[model samples]
Target: MKNTLLICLFVFAALSCKAQNIIPVEDFFDYQNEIPDGTYIKDINNVLNKFTGTWLGSYDNKNYEIVVEEVVYQSQIRTSLTYDQLHLRYKITDANGTILLNTLPLPDDNDYVAMGQYVNPSGAYQLDYAGYEYDCGQSGTLFIKTFNDNTQMKLYLYLGESPYNEDDCPNGFAEQEFPTNSQMLLTKQ
Candidate 1:
């Protein structure tokens, strides 16, 4: 009788612990018709794993260094859903080795940090980018595509124009440290 009671208690305890439902990262949008409130959208195929690491590149005499990392169970921007996403931090330096812009020291939640949004049908990864100068229209969508056996990637920025009062700018808008509407090749370091 005592053994049976212990078994029942153990089963009850096991049942009491709720496990989170896991959905493959690729299937995130397919479930839009029915919202899976607390499900985890994960990279079960390890696609994003290959992109996690340091990438180095250069453009117009400026050196760019980006670090990619996977963040698991990150809460969605405006919902109860959680998912695994890529986090990007970068540092740009001038030809003379002077720092132009650096976001490596910022926290993951900082506005300057780029957050992964989704992968498109063409297998290109998209991320929401907000630079330190976002208030002046330095924010946009960033696209990354892996190539050459995942050792190289192409980074492109599509700047989204933000509406700001004309009076805010006395000397006009400053050019982005990174390229806008163009792509740069990066090699995994």
Candidate 2:
């Protein structure tokens, strides 16, 4: 009887603890009470303007450039391709005058914007090139140092896995034995 009673009490205690652990969605975020001063907002805008110009650089002997055509704060998501919930959008182009990529500013929902593909696996958000999908892995400490305001370089340190999937290379893709590294350099256009 005592054992049964103890079990019931334990279950009740566990249920109680679980109930206490749950947090209401409404209470998850605490809204800020005060608005920012005008000067502070202006300073932020100035800093943003610094990031709004064209940047140019090179990586792996391939020249690249990016033109920040538009900057939007608190941007709304009209569509997935055009000005979604991103802070900014920079029209990117390569040296050969080919449209290479698009740079979207960081999203409020995520901790980091897909910055030059240092930490994305599926390569869904990375700049795609012919025959090679660059910057598509979870990056380590060395990856962060490659990023700079003027010239951004991303290195996909391929340990051993094939960068191309079976669908990409169907002719029985050869297994990679050594670590391969690919670099992408972005400069403001």
Candidate 3:
């Protein structure tokens, strides 16, 4: 009887450990509750659909303009948008035809995660690389206005202070006030 009880306790402990590691799908869908009942939901989906492609833009800092290109692709229906940002040097491709400076795949799966910001109907948000969770502290709205089938404009607004502002790298850049608009001209490939 004692041996059986010990085995049960060990099983219970093991299950508890596994539960701690499990991330529920609901956590990632927290933004769903913020969506309005009617028209807003469809509007969100429309904006997200427009985001599926390659976007190229430049950030000018007086003297130097860094040409940045971002390639975004949707995963399976429920999967998060996976993307990579590359510096457009002389040529775009790496030795293996992959984009240069591509982000390494996350350990959870063989998928590359985007750095900087990601905006969906759920809201403008930032993903935590170390913990692999959607951070509530970095919430904002990404307003995307479609001009046509080929042209769209994006405005990213951080509702509050940006969580990344404290760091010194890309993750640490300061959040701009509302209407920090950036335009992208996408040529579907």
Candidate 4:
């Protein structure tokens, strides 16, 4: 009789407590429930974020320092914006500490920048922009390869411009040869 009475009293107390305040159980399988309010998720893209920063390297007896500045991705869809475009400006000085190449853009030049970005998930970002020459001819392409957790980078420039000496040769150039063919290995500074 005492055991039955005790069981009945325990059941009554549990029912009364549940009736006082109730808490809804979250569904464990729901994806949205896992993320709490006032938090966000970043879209991890294999593009500009990894490659943008100051990098140091050397090529042709010159020490090079380049900055991969991120530019806004202007798209029709507002939600799809990211640091997709990049301005790969650099400052290359000779071993003697004399400046050889410094094309680093000023901060105010955001209206019209140098380079645009194309994605390469496997290795690098294919950048299409005007050649780094005042009068080479026209536009060109830059292949910026990155590795080692964005600590290392390699830049290969393939300029698509014609020779000014059209009269001297009288024949077209056999292959695509740039006046300034360059390859650089750089590390993030």
Q: Considering every candidate listed, which one attains the maximal TM-score?
A: 1
Candidate 4 lDDT tens digits, 1-189: 999999999999988865433211111123323433322222234346778899888766778777887665433434433333667776768789998656675552432235644554455666654533323343467778788887898887666564445555445333321224766788998
Specify the poorest-scoring 10-residue window by lDDT in model 1. 14-23
Ranking under lDDT, best-scoring first?
A: 1, 4, 3, 2
| Steric clash pairs (candidate 1) | none
Candidate 1 has an lDDT of 0.81
Model 2 lDDT-worst window of ten: 78-87
In order, candidate lDDTs are 0.81, 0.34, 0.34, 0.57
Give the lDDT of residue 154 in candidate 2: 42
- Model 1 segments beyond 4 Å from truth? 1-20, 32-34, 76-79
TM-score of each: 0.84, 0.29, 0.30, 0.56
Model 1 Cα displacement at 108 (Å)? 0.8
35: Cα error in model 1, Å: 3.0
4-94: candidate 1 lDDT, tens digit per residue: 9999999887655434467677666667557566666778888788788999999989999999999964574646677788989999998
Q: Give lDDT tens digits, candidate 2, residues 1-189.
A: 999999999999988865554332122122113322210111222322333345455554344444432222231332211121112233345556665544445343332222222122321122211112322332221121224553443423334232546665555454321114654444444
How large an RMSD does model 4 have? 14.7
Q: Candidate 3: minimum summed lDDT over ten consecutive residues — where?
A: 58-67
Look at candidate 4 and give me any clashing residue pairs.
none
lDDT of 1 at 177: 65
